[model samples]
Target: MTIDAKRIVVLVPARNEEHSVADVVLEVSAALPGATVVVIDDGSTDRTADEARRAGAVVLSMPFNVGIGGAMQTGFIYARERGFRAAVQVDGDGQHVPSEIPRLIECLEEGADMVIGARFLGRGDYRAPLLRRLGMHLFSAALTVLTRRSFHDTTSGFRATGRRGIEFFARTYPSDYPEPEAILLLCRAGYDVREVPARIRERESGASSITFFRSIYYMIKVLLAIAMGMTRRAPVRRRGEER
Candidate 1:
């Protein structure tokens, strides 16, 4: 399929990534010219919104500071309303590379409901923090048990989902610290998930929301969310497809 017919959109949910958002947006836009790009500015106190818009993305600014989950859910809503065939979540912090987008687009074309960029599939160049890696491993294991399928990179933000996945997330998605548990949520809704090989860069600037104190808090919160998503599951039935 040509890029225009695919209706693929790149969703960038940014908080305070003012320094990186501009360059990232421009690069993604150039990489996928036919694809529409939307940047959700989640109430950043800096020039995130202005800079993102100037960089040539369709900017959506939230009135209040919602978390990453909220910002991404908003992007899902946009895709749903705009009749986009697929939506790919890209980090505005310059971690995810734009050149790898075609592989994700190919995944959607190949009939997978969701495709995640696995940083550890064959490369560990991202060099995630030790504690974060532990958290990801633990969550990946727990989610594998819950989903009854192999999911290596549960915390990977580089994910592409089709219209069904977009619609599902528009109605329900993670609120805070949503990386790992969000996969469980997608599985309970009956979407088939796959992981792809991709590399990520370290953050160029700014600070992560997951500080030492918040890391502990996030681990507990995500654990609770995983358990809750498993119990409170309802399949989205589309002509008995269960996807």
Candidate 2:
């Protein structure tokens, strides 16, 4: 299925990813020539914004580091404001393959409110370490129970969403560890969520924010957020409202 590039936006959220952002932005532009590429520079002390801009991507620099969730929500707000029909999110760390973005958009075109590009769903060389894999499994199980849906890779950040999902998230998004919880949020809000197999590469540079201790904290914090989300009411979509 072919989609109008003008109707789609590739949102790259970066922080101190100067080494990798340029290549990622270039690859995304090559993969989808006409799509708008926007890099949310999450207050990087490095030259992330400069590299992204040089690579032909529109840069939105945050005043301070707002983490992944805040950066992504800012991108969604941009998409909504610009009247984009769809939005695809790929990490700026060079882990997610830009070429696979089409596969995610295909699912979205087929009627999925949101499509997750899952790493563990198929045979591949990208493997998380034992401890990290265990943490992922625990969260995947928790999401499955909460949403009553099978989820193989809840932590996958490679995802695409249609207008409704983008608009909904722009209004209210989780602050920390938003990927898995965002999926559950869409499901509870009556949106169709789907997943497909995709590949991941090792980061080109820089250390991961998730450490042995931080991964544990991430699990606890995300789980609590998901539980709280279940009890809260989703906002009603108001028509004729400006994005």
Candidate 3:
């Protein structure tokens, strides 16, 4: 079953990415014609919002920097409220290839509640720094054990979700380090989450948000969040199963 492009929304969460946000918006528009491109400007001091608007994207400007997690939740909330059937997350820095969005949507159509665009799935030559690679491997292993399912790129931000995922995340999403935590949340709730190979490019401009010290902090905080999440009861029962 081919989903209509009009029922999909491409969400771009940007912070201080004035130089590349416009181009990213344009690229997404071209890649997925007829889809709504909404840019969640996470309190960027630069002209990120203006650039996105000028590039023909709907802009949601936050009052202040709410981090990636908050920005993404805002997009999901919008998707849920606006009645979009599916939503795709494309980063503002141009790392994610908008052209690959259809692959994710295909997974959603195939009964996946959420689809992650994994970078290290043997499809791309994209390489992370040594420290970041180690973190990814560690998170993948931890999530594999906790969820009883394999995960390769737990830290990947490129993703897409169907209506079920959109509604669930809108209601309850983590505030920090949400990517990995979100996987656990969905699995515990018995949602089908899958990963697909995707090629990623280096950021078009600006430095990465994860600095050396912040990487350490991110790892520690996310692990703690996962541990706490494990003890909490599943927010929703498995799909198509009795309560």
For all predicted structures, in order, the TM-scores are: 0.93, 0.95, 0.96
User: Which portions of model 2 miss their true places by more than 4 Å?
Assistant: 239-243
For 120-175, candidate 3 gives per-residue lDDT tens digits of 99888998889888889989999999999999999999999999998888887888
Give per-residue CA lDDT, model 2, range 60-99, as digits (tens). 9999998899999999999999999899999999999999
Superposition TM-score, candidate 2 onto the true structure: 0.95
| Candidates arranged by TM-score, highest first | 3, 2, 1
Worst 10 residues of 2 by lDDT: 234-243
Alpha carbon RMSD to native, model 3? 3.1
lDDT of 1 by residue, 1-243 (tens): 433534988999998899999998998988888788899999999999999999888999999998898889899989999999889999989888888888887887888788899999886477778888888888989998988998888888998888788888887778888777667777787778888998887877777778877887888899988887778746554434211
Question: lDDT of each structure?
Answer: 0.84, 0.89, 0.92
Error of 2 at 129 (Å): 1.7
Clash pairs (backbone) in predicted model 3: none
Checking candidate 1 for backbone clashes, the offending pairs are none
The positional error of residue 67 in candidate 2, measured at the CA in angstroms, is: 1.1
Instruction: Judge candidate 1 at residue 30 and give its lDDT.
Output: 85
TM-score for candidate 3, residues paired by index: 0.96
